[model samples]
Target: MKLKIIAPIAAACLAAVPGAVAQADNTNFISRPLSLLDCLNIALRHNASILEAQRDLKASQGIVIQTRAVALPQLSVNGQYKDTERTAIESFGPPASSGGPAFSISPPVQNWNGDVQLVQAIYSGGRLAAAWQAAGVTRKQAAAQYDTAVAGALLDTRLAYYDVLLANQQITVQEASVTLLQKELEDQQNRYQAGTVPHFNVLRAEVALANEQPALIQARNNFRIAKNNLANLLGYNLPRDIWEDVPLNLSGSLDDRPCPVNLPDAIRQALAHRTELTALRETERLRQLNVVNARSGYKPDVSVFAGYGWKNSQFVDPGDLAYTLHGWNAGAQVSWDIFDGWLTRGKVVQAQALYKKSQISLADEARQIELQVRTAYSQFVEAGEVLDSQKKVQEEAEEALREAEARATAGTGTQLDVL
Candidate 1:
């Protein structure tokens, strides 16, 4: 029996063995005949999914900036120009002899106005503060998600690399078997020709070799497909419509390693370090902030604004309708939804429900992760036992083959056993 493993050999049981696939530097990207570490490095650098996750994390930072801006001072500059033919100047007097007729006093006069305003939030009943904190938590969630994406990419690269190795080994073993069968077939033919063995012996040997051809052909095709899979995981930028071998050769081999870490320690590590749990913890914090934000609606919102503004009427010269005016203004704002038709209450209730749900989800996820760690360790143990048995079985098979050959040569056994 053959054991085919990929990611778990390194990902789950890392540092448990003295030396295996875990000793190389994955950060070196320029080397040829890529090892597992090299493949992992390339996958992390070029994988589309990982890149997308990083972009998402950057976008979350923007969200954090926007939310925090709500609590900080805002400065703005504005300008406006207007020309109007109609005015109250006609009503100012029955007729204007100040210059010419009323028509001369007002004829599409130009006016300019400008303002520089500063607005600062004095209070928000905790709304702005909670929102800002929630945004920060959202960024944390994005960071955790990015970590998860990286971990997943590394695992996929490992699986693809292992697939290529497994298929290659299968082909090598099958070819060897075919060679031995071919020799047995030739010997059978020679013995039959000399009238020393029956024709049945020749046919049996031929059948045995023929049976291996289909499997051998399949193994070769599988090797090619596995290479393609590995190349895809490595994110090769190949031309469209071309099916080819991997650009880089693989230099790493799967060596059997020992598992020394116990199940309890594995579970503890998974709990402390799993990105999914970290992301969920961030979600729980975000939900708590949402509750605070909702409760803010019960209190009045307050802010203050100050501005320097210029209006045409302040220094308007009716003679030419030219204006050059500037002034300062300041005011405080207060808005209270003392009776909002129960809207605030409903919002608070909804936020509370969601926060409670997040708590339950976090707890459930922790349990599931613990169970997963236990299961994985148990499987690893079982696989080790099976591998030990396979070694013993191989030794027994080799000894049996030698005995059969000796017996056949001594004329105490049929050629069938050797074949």
Candidate 2:
């Protein structure tokens, strides 16, 4: 029953590769061997940080709609109703003929007015247009930010994947060493039992095996911790191995694949493709639009409106029912902000300052990206050199092992040396 539930969730997370997860043992251990692509696809869908960035992109699109609305026409409805009583009508007359029969004036008993209006903004001193453009640029910036988030998530996942691979490789080496030590200990014990070697040889072999045991244990523990860290980054719980008490199965190797690009080319590509720089460029455009929007406050706005309305007649006979009147009206409007205690000027200054700040930020970010690219290139070179040295060391170790075996076979070297 539990597996039925887990199977669906696991499938959804790794939907790109259906049936990647399955029951591996009777104890319900989930054995899923995920490759690098599988991990990347899962992270793109399920990672929390990337999901938040996606929401931000959607929100920015909404802002574009809102900003564009300001440049479009608007429609509205208005209604009013009024009821007049006798005493209220009497208050409009002068003492009602000096109290003669307590006479009073008469007004309409009830009246209603309604209208449908449409207003079109012919001009908004360029503020509306600039704001719309700014909104578009803002959306671009949000998209770039989303790209940046995706890139960061993928890079971190790659690093974690490599870390797990390294740990797994270390475990393999440790296990091999432990097996070799066990064989050596068995050989030493046999020699001792046959009275051909001293007890000290057996003791030495035991100690060597004991010393190797701790390293093997530590290596296995490291592998488990690395796998757990990877599972956390993937935003999912990995099913454990019930048979060996192990972790989720991973697929891939740590093969050396060096980047061939040089330092200058790398820096060039980083400057061109880095999402942070793209987002900043969009922000700079948005800020420039803001400056235009602020400057528009100095000019007047113009609009046109047309409406059709109905109302009861304004004047009627005292005891007669009021007649209804309907009419159409249209007009043009212009509004000027002649004075506001330098409010427009203040806004202009603030917008300009922010624009300048955006430019500075863009330049600084570009420089930072260049520096990072150069540093990474240097590190790549250093790592390549170290890898070359390690390869040479491995070759020399293999040659020494062969020489030791030959010496032991010839009876000029001890068995421990070859082991």
Candidate 3:
């Protein structure tokens, strides 16, 4: 019994040791091999904002479909019923009093009728044509907006991803510094016991280690935050024990080069492709159509109508009693508004104002895009330059540290001097 308990406890302790060591190693290991394109691709599929924009685009497409349906014929069905009580009436004709007062038509000709009709708009003063154009433009606008959303989301993802990479790199630099200091501290302690170096040297090493600790901690925190952000974008709840190892790749200029296009060229591309500008232009066109429709109010409208009905003296006019039916009538209809109390003029003015406002908005959006593209391009290039500069600085720092160590080992350099 004693041996069995001891064996299980020893085994448990052994397993726990490896697990603890693994956890520590994993936290220190970080991956930095991802690129902007890879991140953008991931964001396109997973970013919530991009998904919402896509859904909105689909809804706009539905609207276009509804507008396109305007060309189809409209059909309607209608019915009516009537009841009457006998009443006498007089009739007047060419004889001044053609019939006695009580001898005229009675019961006011009771009737019932039902009919179904269809109307197809052959023309509408170019309103339908303009509307169709507007719908097409709206769809184009939606597509452009979706593209803009994708681009913006990709930019944000790249920024966050690189932030994490930079944090990890800084952490690595600090950790290496700490290792060197720890070795120096041990050496200083040994020398102090031997009376070869002052205790102050050992104290100095301790101070350096202490100073480096905070930076390392901060870097780790930043790394965790960055990983969390990326995980969120990928729609994951990052595990508490999550860790990654950096993948090494040879440096290539092709992967890091800036856009070669000039600012003017970029602006031109935006004007041609930006979704908001297209949407605004479509809105202006639609407003112009509204103006046309308002003006059309002054023009006359023409349509044809035809109907048939039956009348009988009997109360029940079933299908077999068709002999009591009358004939049918058909004619053209003409309606002219002639004039309203300035309502038409006010509508025209309102539409024109909206059209002018849309024009202004389009201009504003174009200028804004021009500014944004230029600014983003500048920032992108600047980040590359800064990264390159930091790389050189880091290399120089490492070389200097190596030289200092060699000189110190040769016994020609003091502890403070090497530091």
Computed on alpha carbons, the lDDT of every model, listed in order, comes to 0.76, 0.74, 0.61
Q: How many clashes in each structure?
A: 0, 0, 0
Q: After superposition, how far is residue 124 of candidate 1 from its true place, in Å?
A: 1.3
Give the clashing pairs for model 2.
Answer: none
Q: Can you give the lDDT of residue 198 in candidate 3?
A: 82
lDDT of 3: 0.61
lDDT at position 218, candidate 1: 91
Please report, as a residue range, the 10-residue window in candidate 3 with the lowest summed lDDT: 15-24
* Candidate 2 per-residue C-alpha lDDT over 203-266 given as tens digits, one digit per residue, 9 for 90 to 100: 8988999999999999888888777666666666444543333456667677765446566766
Which residue ranges in model 3 land beyond 4 Å of their true spot? Answer: 1-42, 68-72, 80-113, 122-126, 237-261, 304-331, 416-419
Per-prediction TM-score, please?
Answer: 0.85, 0.78, 0.69
Q: Using TM-score, give the best candidate's number.
A: 1
List residue ranges in candidate 1 displaced over 4 A: 1-31, 87-90, 93-108, 239-244, 314-316, 319-321
RMSD of each: 4.9, 7.6, 13.6
lDDT for 250 in candidate 3 is 12
What tens digits encode model 1's per-residue C-alpha lDDT throughout 63-123?
8888788788999999998765655334233357567666433433566788999999878
The clash number for model 3 is 0
